[model samples]
Target chain A: MKQLTIQSSSHAYDVIIGAGLRKKLSQKLGKSYKKILIVTDSKVSSLYLEDVKAGLPDHENLSHVIVPAGEASKSMEQYSRLLDKCIEEQLDRSSLIVGLGGGMVGDLAGFVASTYLRGVDFLQMPTTILAHDSSVGGKVAINHEQGKNLIGSFYSPVQVIYDTDTLRTLPDSEVRSGYGEVVKHALLSDMDWVKEVLSEDFSELSYSQLGDHLLAGIKVKASIVEEDEKEHGVRRHLNLGHTLAHALESDLGYGEITHGEAVAIGIFFAMKVSEKVLESTLPVDAYSAWLKTNEYPVEKLSNLNPERLVNRMKWDKKTIEDRIHFVLLKGVGSPAVVPIPEDDLVNHLKEFIEEVIQIDERD
Target chain B: MKQLTIQSSSHAYDVIIGAGLRKKLSQKLGKSYKKILIVTDSKVSSLYLEDVKAGLPDHENLSHVIVPAGEASKSMEQYSRLLDKCIEEQLDRSSLIVGLGGGMVGDLAGFVASTYLRGVDFLQMPTTILAHDSSVGGKVAINHEQGKNLIGSFYSPVQVIYDTDTLRTLPDSEVRSGYGEVVKHALLSDMDWVKEVLSEDFSELSYSQLGDHLLAGIKVKASIVEEDEKEHGVRRHLNLGHTLAHALESDLGYGEITHGEAVAIGIFFAMKVSEKVLESTLPVDAYSAWLKTNEYPVEKLSNLNPERLVNRMKWDKKTIEDRIHFVLLKGVGSPAVVPIPEDDLVNHLKEFIEEVIQIDERD
Candidate 1:
């Protein structure tokens, strides 16, 4: 098992990545907290909630809360209902909360644990590959009616248990969806990994090999999260594909497209923009070919309206003073945070849209 | 003008309390931010938005957002609408949000400013006396459908401008409502101030005198906020009256009573508990008489259902693992944070209700 730590002002938690780590939680937590509140999604609850509950020390008090599965569950109404559950269940300051699911569960549960009773200790037991990215960071929040994650706090979990065994149960589509985020980490930092991922056929990669790649991705993300937990400076680089990705998610209607799928298309657009703005040498055709080989959506760009997408991009949480900032890449593994004026971004979107449409029409 | 600073990981802002300090905002902020988004309730906008706007340095970048007046406006729907407004207006990272009004506006606007683009520079331009408490600490949040402030963050403002001149337009009930929070501050920290406040007739305190008390109360509260920005330890003391106060607010329905009025009754209950639990030497008769003199609902406790109030208290954000903790005072100015087991709290509630009913029947 490899152990990594996330240090933040609000909390410091260890991320343990290995097989069969779920059984060790009781010994790991000991009897520090009086009781434990385990928050999981319905999907995870059916799969591993019993394993987690059995793993806890028999002496410590425990209860479980199961939320609906999906991004739609991370709303203010759910958050309020969860708080009511905590109160009804009598969770206190000395109690601990274990987030036992993927990123949505982790974010929602972490947020509930963070704000309930002002704050409480939370353990992240991420059960999906996507959580490899979300679990390491202490950014806990819920979505508001206005936007995603509009209301939340920066509360870190006490420990993050990434059991590779959990990934075995994930659907193939989920695995493919998570690869987008994994690719994001590679694009932002690991050129060697990016080259390796590009060269290999994902269907041929073994489960252990996939775990290794996920670990590598998480390490890159963890390093960034460690330095800038609140997305102030260096952390912005981690948002390499997020600019267009978030816009696509909002424009397409959130939850309709997986986060990773949007991120995949976002990375494609980001690479094009990087080539244009930073004069970077990108193997665009080769990259596009690899994405197509993997059956990823390599030509969805033609379906979206450039103006609406651009407008949606303006609402990105990272924007400042009417100016939208893009985390562009100078080269693979060389990311730069750049503030592009809104009009300039819109113009760039128009040009990119026309280029992609012309290519699709010729094809 | 007296200047006080609250230093927290998310926010470091100065509290400038004095007459005519609104003009100093432009000088204080200077060119640090490119634009300003002033968020205020309709009542304050109609009265002082122009004066506050005039205080700006003629930056064509300045704009304002007016929300409806009252706590009802601090909902997730409103919070989402505000984010849409920010996106439409192009308020960015370098933008500044100025919250102008009472606790409702401060909490709602502060939450908007905090979450807008992850966060931006927020200033608290408090138009009501109650904001003397809300503005200092960066406890910005919007109410969720299930409960009050169920979704929020600890994002502090950049500066707090408490213009005493604005208090002249405040209704008498509103002014008295603010005194509840001020009295809470004094009761929790300054025994001398509590004595002075109790000695004087409520009608005798002038606006300037009240402002002085407000500043003094804020200073005491600000010190605690500086020590514990996220309520890990000392900050919990700020919720002295809030335990029962929040329960009352929730039970009676939020719109039925102002925060201060609920808090005033909460303080009375807390004091009673203090006398019971801590065996503190409290002038119970004198205190009850002072509350009566101010037209505070010293007898309203009889009307509330003890069982319902206890049930509602369970939903308090401070409770953990089904245990309710009360912030009780050992004496006036000697506040203590205590965790009460569920059964013990229930028993205390029973006793408290019985006493209040007995007193009401005698009257």
Candidate 2:
């Protein structure tokens, strides 16, 4: 097992990644918490909740709160219900919360754990490949009616257990979705890995090979998170593709397009803008072609309105003084965050969308 | 103007307490924020919103979101609406939110300011005497359906402007309620002030005198918050009468009893318990008689089930490992936070309730 630590102002925790790490949870968590609440999605609860439960020590009290699968569960209603569950079940400050699913479940559970009884010890046991990225970061939040993650806190978990064995049950679509985040990490930091992933068809990659990719992706993300845990500085670099990606998600409505898919498209557009504005050395056509090869909707630019998209970007949390900031690439491996005036950003979006539409017409 | 700085992690603000300090707001806030969202309740908005607006730097970007008056307004619905208002008003990360009301408005607006766009700069322009305590601390939250302050964060304001001029419009009842928190601060920290307040009949304390008490009370509370920002250690001392006080508010239904009235009863009960278990030096009979002399409900204990009250105390956030902790007094001046086992706490509650019921019969 490989152990990593997340250092934050309030507290720090260990992240253990390896096969069969679930078995060691009883030994690891027994000292800190006596009562544990396992929060998982319905699909995950049916398949692995019992196995995870069996790993807890015999003396430790345990309960479970099963939420429905998918992003819809990260709503205010669900968060309220989770609080009711904690109050009803008598989970106190010393009680532990274990998030046992993908990013959605982790985000929702992390939020519930953070606010419940003013805060509690939470352990992240991410079951999907995508969570390798989400689970490492301390950003936990639930969606409000206004926007996604509008209500949340920066609360880190006590420990994280990433068992490779859990990935065997994932659907192909889920795996593909997870790959988008992996590509994001690679694009932001590991250019060599980006080249390797782009070299072959993603369909040809084996499950074990995919695990290696996920681990590599997480390493890049983990390093950035360590330096700027609260996204005040270097951690904003991790939001390379997310600026446009979040706007796309907000405009299209969350859950219509997977977070990873939106990010993948955003990454493509960012590359184009970077090559134009930053004079970055990215071959934009080759990058777009690679995304196309992976079945990413590289031609979705025509469906999006540049004006509306620009307006949506204005609401981005990273923005300051009405200027939209973009994380641009200086080169293949080097990424830089720059703030562009609203009008300049709008003009760039208009030109980029026109170019992508022309490419679609040719195709 | 007396300037006091409250140092919290990522939140450091100065509390400028004096008359006419609101006029200097533009100089204090300067160009740090482009837009301002002044949040106040209907009553305070009608009274002082214009004064606060004039305090700004004549920026056309200023807006206001008014919530309803009273504790009932501090609900999730109000919090959600506040966020929606923020989105509609285009309050971004660099925007400023000034909470201009009593404790409820300060809490609700502070909560909105904390979570909207994942947090923005907030200033507290307290209009009511109660706000003197609420404004200084970074504790901002809306009440949940299940409990008070069940949903919130430790997000402090950028600056606190407590203008004594605003206190002139406060009703008699409002002034008395604000004194509850002041009395709590004194009982927990400063014995001299407690003696002075206890010596006077409730009717004799004028509104101006109440303001003086508030300033002194806030100093004690602020000092505690500065020492233990997160409530991990010394700050727990601030929760002296809150354990039972919160339970009473939840049981009686919010808005049924004023926060101060319930806290006064809780303080009386806590002193009795402290004398029973810790051999406290406090004159419990004299304290009980003083509460009665002030027309405070010293007989409310008979209506509550000791077991149910004890059960609620068990779920308190301060309780660790199922042991309920109390911030009891060695005397009026020296307060000590002590942990008592669940059974012992229940026994003390039962005995105290019986003693109070007997006292009521004698009266």
Candidate 3:
């Protein structure tokens, strides 16, 4: 077990990552919070809800709200229902609202905790590997009809407890989806970490090795978050692959492709753009080969219209004052936000899509 | 025009209070914000929307969203609709959400501003005198079916522009309702301000005098907010009359009674509780007489059941660990939060209601 204490402007909290950390929930909490509402999804409720409850401090009032599994659960309806549930449970300002699932449950519960009774004590218990990224940063939100995570806030939790034991239950697809972000974090750090993550066979990794990778990713994210909690500056680098990821999710009608899957594709596209636009010498071929070997749907770019994808990018929430900003890497580990002219971006995207298709044909 | 700069823990902003201050909106907005969405109410839209638009900077992206004018507008439905409206209008991160109207409008718009695009720039254009108190504190929220302000956050606005010229159109009842908070603010401050507000007739105060009173009220609230932005300790004192006020608002059903009127009654009851429970001589009779003269519906207490009001107080959002905390005064200015026994609270409430009814009868 290892603990990393993150210092955000609001407060400092510890992110404890290890196998079977759920049992240490009480000791980690440090203070007594009598009323606790555990928010989890349906799939995990039967698996880990009772275990989490049993791990709480004695005499604490506990209730569980099980939302349906998947991204669809992040909706306005669910947000309102959970808020009403908080009131029905009589959870007050001093109460605890624990998010006990993956990123979806964490986002919904964190947002509810931030708004309910003008915010209550919030704790994140991330079950899936995908949540290792979402739970660390305080960016919590529910999806809007027009866009994903259109409604939310930057509300940090008191403590994040990740019991890696739960990660075993995640499907192989979920594992692949989570690794996309891990790879991106590795690329964002340095060339050596990128090679380390690329060379390692994910399926062969022991729990300890997996914890090390998750910890590394979290450290990179936490450092950026600490410097720019509100995303007013360098924090924009965290969204290195997100501009295209959000556009892909919106264009493909979310749920067709997993978030991290889209992020993998986005990271590939951003790297290509970096090499082309910034004249950076990033190893695009090696990154592309790693993505394809890892089963990322890089060939999806060939099937979709580059124009439509570009249009979707224009509509991304990160667009500032009608100017579409893209976070591009000058090289491995050197990311910067750059605004590309629409015409140049469209032409570059068309050529990039053709090159990807030709590479797939050769394979 | 009086400009008072308030420094909360989050940021510093100016409260510009004067007749026709809206005319100086462009000048006061230190920077250029291209996208401005004015979220007002049906009543305020017709009264000052165009004038506000004319006062804005040239060639800026502008839109307006108007909800029905009343407490009912502060609902999840309205909140959801306005969020959708923001999306429909293509409001970006750099946009400004200007809330124009009374407390209801301010609460709804401020909340939407704080959450839209994970919060945007928010400005308060308080049109009603009742708004002078609500606009300053950054206590923005929407109502829940179970309670008032059951969902909200402590998100501050960039600037608060109060044009006292709008005060002239308020009905006599509205004037009385707004005065309840003015009176409460005076009570929270020194005894001299209390005498100044109490001694004057509500009907005859010129806009300049009204602005002075409003500025004083704002100063009291701003100082409290600066000390405790999230209502941790000293901030609870600002809720001196709010314990009964919220219970009254909930029990009586919102919109049935103006918030300030309930606050007026709550203030009177709190003063009596202070004298009886703490053995403080606060001159409760004089305060009761002042309420009567100001046309505050204090007599409604006699018609209601004290037991029910006491029960509702226990369910207040401010209730910590099921303990109802009431803000009490030792004298005129000094205030503290005290948790009273339920049975004692009921007995005192019953006696106080009877005492108020007798005073009305003798008059």
State each model's C-alpha RMSD to the native: 4.5, 3.2, 1.6
What candidate 2 gets wrong by more than 4 Å, as runs, is A22-24, A58-60, A206-209, A250-256, A283-286, A317-323, A341-363, B21-24, B27-32, B206-212, B283-293, B317-323, B341-363
Which of the two candidates, 2 or 3, achieves a greater lDDT against the reference? 3
Top-scoring candidate (DockQ): 3
What's each prediction's TM-score? 0.83, 0.90, 0.97
lDDT of 1 by residue, B1-363 (tens): 677777767656677888776656776662467778888888889888888888787668888888899888988678767877776667766778888888988898887776565567788888888889888877877765556776577777778888888888877567667888888888877667887777757676676787788878888888888888878788888887787888888877867777887787787778888888899876667666676677765455666776677777776654434667788888877788877777777777778777766765675
Best by TM-score: 3
Arrange candidates by DockQ, descending. 3, 2, 1
Calculate each model's fnat, 2 decimals: 0.30, 0.40, 0.80
**Clash list (residue pairs), candidate 3:** none
What would the per-residue lDDT of candidate 1 be over residues A1-363, giving only the tens digit for each residue? 777666776656677888877777876773477778888998989989888888887544788888899899998678767877776666666788889999999898887886664467888998888788888777777775556776566778888888888888987557767888888888776568788777757677677777787778878987887888877789888787887988887877877677887787788788888888899987677667666667665456667777787777766654534677788888887888777777777788878777766755565
For model 1, chain A alone compared with the true chain A gives a TM-score of: 0.92
Tens digits of lDDT, candidate 2, A13-47: 77777777666678766366657888999999988
- DockQ for candidate 3: 0.77
For residues A106-163, write the lDDT of model 3, one tens digit per residue.
9999999999988888999998878889999799999887888889988999999899
Off by over 4 Å in 3: A57-60, A320-323, B58-60, B320-323
Writing each residue's lDDT as its tens digit, candidate 3 over B1-363 gives: 898998866789999988887776888896787688999999989989988998887645888889999999999999999999989888888788899899999999999988887889899999888898999978899998778899998888999999999889998778888888998889988888888877877767777788899999999988888888888889888788888888888887877789888888889889989988788878676777778787787667767887898888877744554457789999888898887888888888889889888988887
